[model samples]
Target: MEVLSIVLGGGKGTRLFPLTQSRAKPAVPFGGRFRLVDIPISNCINADFRQIYILTQFNSASLHLHLSQTYVFDSFTRGFVEILAAEQTFEHSGWYEGTADAVRKNFIHFRTQNPKYYIILSGDQLYRMDLKELLSKHRDSGAAITIATTAVSREDASQLGILKANKNNEITEFMEKPGPVKDISDFKIPAELRQDKNGKGDEYLGSMGIYVFNAEAMESCLANELTDFGKEIIPAAINKLKVNAYLFDGYWEDIGTIRSFYEANLDLTTLRPKFDFYDEDAPIYTHMRNLPPSKMNFSNMNQSIAAEGCIITNASITNSIVGVRTIIESGSSLNGVVCMGADYYESEIQKQQNAEARVPNIGIGRGAIVKGAIIDKNACIGEGCRIGVDAIPRVDGNYGHYYIVDGIIVIPKNAVLYPGAVI
Candidate 1:
């Protein structure tokens, strides 16, 4: 079957502010090396469905550059990965209002591919799925639209689109973010579909924001003024169309907020992380920066991940992720930190210039102590600096060079912290 994939690069990620201050949500760095967009793109590639298009609008420059540099298909094949950026045209001029609106606006371009099916994915989620299996299930069931669902607790179901499916796996009802007050006990999964039935609690099927749509169904659904899939199209489709659910029990995370992002990155430093990047059979791909191996000088690192070209001095690092080209000076200690490294190493002349300007160079300086924080790219943590370590509670808001979101300290990109700085 001729299938096409569209990844919805989300709107302004306000919840992940400071990090999303200068780049698209999908372009945010994750797991030391890979971008958030890499997860879905790599899944599509691994499934051998490569005629992909990423739909993005806000702050897309960095995402565009990363995609152009990373996902180039071979010339011999018809496969390609392209970006369908939001545009102002004669028909509709406003930016993408919602997920469905984005696809509807691009229908003119999508028709040229003449695809039989389209797989919709979220750009800011982390999951690995076999699209081939999803397609097979869709075709076999003769479903017009198939949504990927996962079992979630009542608390999680309240925050996501929960659905009810019959024993045949056909979706019956859909509810979007029915908060804690909503009585959604009827939306629980059928007993036959439940893997664990020790009578723990009601398990509801939460939408993963992943969908497989027949070409005609997608066009028909988007023909209306509905702007969102979860809030409008999918719920409407459930009443009129043959919508099915492909139940998945896998490690999936939506890194849409600062707290979720921070916890997810720190999770990777654990001895056994739920998400594995070491799976060589289905590898996650990114820009091939040919940097040398990391160099550590008398450092004590435990349950930490340091990317290539890092120069770590006599520091004590535990449960942290040090990104590429990072330079951690001696006498520093990092615990439960996610440090996104610099874009380029500072030359001797550049260091001299920084000294002359009375500014700290990129990366953490000597005698610094960081704990439970996210250090964005090119940030300079000066000597004797302290972050997320003091007993003083910080309210969540912008604080000049840094921010406190969900009780986690965030150092935005290229922000400089002079010597003896504290947070």
Candidate 2:
């Protein structure tokens, strides 16, 4: 069946702060080499559902640039991955208020294509999914709307939209952000859907912010002015239409907050990471820099993922992600950190750091120490600097030099940590 995918390039991403300060959430660099947006976009391409339109608003320039540079289809093919930034028209002259509203505003574009089904996706999530399976389940069940779900523990209920599915996987109920103390025991998944088959099956079924809607169903729902899908559309659709739940049995992480984003990146350096970028068959595509091989001079590293164009000299690293174009000087040590290296080589703009406010272009300096931290792009850590060492055990607030979320220090984009600076 003909399908069109719509990826929601997320809003402000306040939780991600410094990283999303300059670029959209999806455009945020991830996994050392790829962007958060690459996950959903690559999934659509791998599933052969090539027609896609990304809906974005805040800080979308970088996201747009990345798309234009990376996703270029063949001349003969009709497929394309295009950007649909929020705009004003005769019908509506305001920004997208919510998820449903974003899609509602883009109806004119999709109506022309006349797709058989429409798939909705989130750009900031880390997961590898095959949309073909979701489409197949929707077709087999004859459901007007199909929601992709995964079992979440009671502890995670407050962070997601929980649901209840019957024996046939038809959703009967949904509760969005039902706070931790609230009881959701009645909304557990069925025993048959559990991985252990005979396990507890008490885990709540949570929405992955993924959905497949029948052309007619989506058009009919959009006729109204509902703003959000989870808070309005999906909950309302369950009562009037056949909404089925499709369970996902793989690793899926919502990188909406700094802690989750930090942990997810560090996971990439683990022995058996939940999400593997090394999978060749379903490779995550990105801008191929074609840079020279990384150079290392007596550097000691263990279980780390260092991208190309990185220069390491006498540094010791363990369980870290060193991004592209990084330069780590001698006597520097990094452990359990994510250093999102610079996008380009050092420039004249970098030399005038004292004249005008600017972040250092290079990655790190000599004798610096970083542990359990996330250094965003264009950051320059001066010699004798110490980051993440003074981080509070568990705090979520802004400190002048850096922000601490879940106790992990985060240096914002284009920021500078001067010599002997401490977190």
Candidate 3:
């Protein structure tokens, strides 16, 4: 089947403020070495669905650069990964209002591929699946649309679009983010679909924000002024078209907020993360920097992940992710930190210039004690810095040097913490 994958790179990402402040949400650095956009693109390539288009509006320059540098298809194949930024055309001059609107605006470009099936994906989600299975289920069931659903708890259900499906896997009802007050007991997965025969647990089928749509069905669904897929399109489609559910019980995480993003990255430092990047059978692809291997000198590290081109000297790190080109000075200590390393190494002349200007170099300085923080790329933490280590309550907002969101300290990209700084 000829399939075209459309990844919706969300707008603004207000929930992920500082990280999304300068770049698109999907362009935000993730897992030390990869961008959020890499997840969906890698999945598409692994599934042999290479003709992909990423639709974005806000802060897409970095995303475009990353895509161009990372995904280069060979001439032998028709595979191409392209980005379609929101444009002001004569027909529609406004920006993409929502998920469906983004795709609808790019339909003129998508039609050139002439794909029979269109796979809709979210750029900021972390999960791995053989999309061939989704297509197979869509074809076998003869459904106009097939939405990938996952089992989510009641607490999580309130934040996601929940649905109920019959024994035949046909979606019967759909509700978007039914808040705590809404009684959604009737929306639980059918007893037949439950692996537990007793059906004793309350497991609701939550839409994964992943969908497979027949070309005609998608075109028809978007013919209206409906904007979002979850809020408008999917709910309407369930009532008018033959919509089915593709049950997926995988480790899927929506990296939408600061808390979720922080926890997901920290989880990678665990012994066996829910999402593993070491799966050689289905590897996650990213930019090939080919930097030198990370170098450490008497650094006592445990349960940490360090990417290439790092220099560590007599520091202590625990349960952290150190990105490429990171430099941890002597006597510094880090725990539960996700440090996005520098973009480029500073030359001795640059270091001298920094010293003259009384600014710390582009890395963690000596005697720094950082914990439970996210240090964005090219950030500089000066000597004697204390971040997320003090016994003080922090309100969520953007400070001059750092911001605290979800009670976690976030040092934005290119931000600097002066010497003897304490947070």
- Give the whole-model CA lDDT for all candidates, comma-separated: 0.92, 0.88, 0.92
Candidate 1: Cα lDDT at 99:
96
| TM-score of model 1 (CA atoms) | 0.98
lDDT of 3 by residue, 267-369 (tens): 9999989899999988999999989999999999999999999999999999999999999999999999999898899999999999999999999999999
Model 1 regions lying over 4 Å from their true place: 196-202
Q: Model 3, residue 388: what's the lDDT?
A: 88
Model with the higher lDDT, candidate 2 or 3: 3
lDDT sort, best first: 3, 1, 2
Error of 1 at 400 (Å): 0.9
The alpha-carbon lDDT assigned to residue 152 of candidate 1 equals 83
Q: Candidate 3: where are CA atoms >4 Å away?
A: 195-202
**How many residue pairs clash in each candidate at the backbone level?**
0, 0, 0
lDDT of 2 by residue, 1-423 (tens): 389999998788888887888899999999888999999999999899999999999999999999999999998767899999999999989999999999999898988898999999999999999889889989999999999998777777788999988888899998888988987777866555656222434377889999999999998888898899989899999999999999898888999888899999999988889898888988899999899889999999999989999999999999999999999999999999998888898766556764366343367988999998898887889888987766446477777767877777888877778778877
- For model 2, the stretches where C-alpha displacement exceeds 4 angstroms are 196-202, 347-361, 390-395
TM match of model 2 to true structure: 0.94
- Which of 1 and 2 is the better model by lDDT? 1
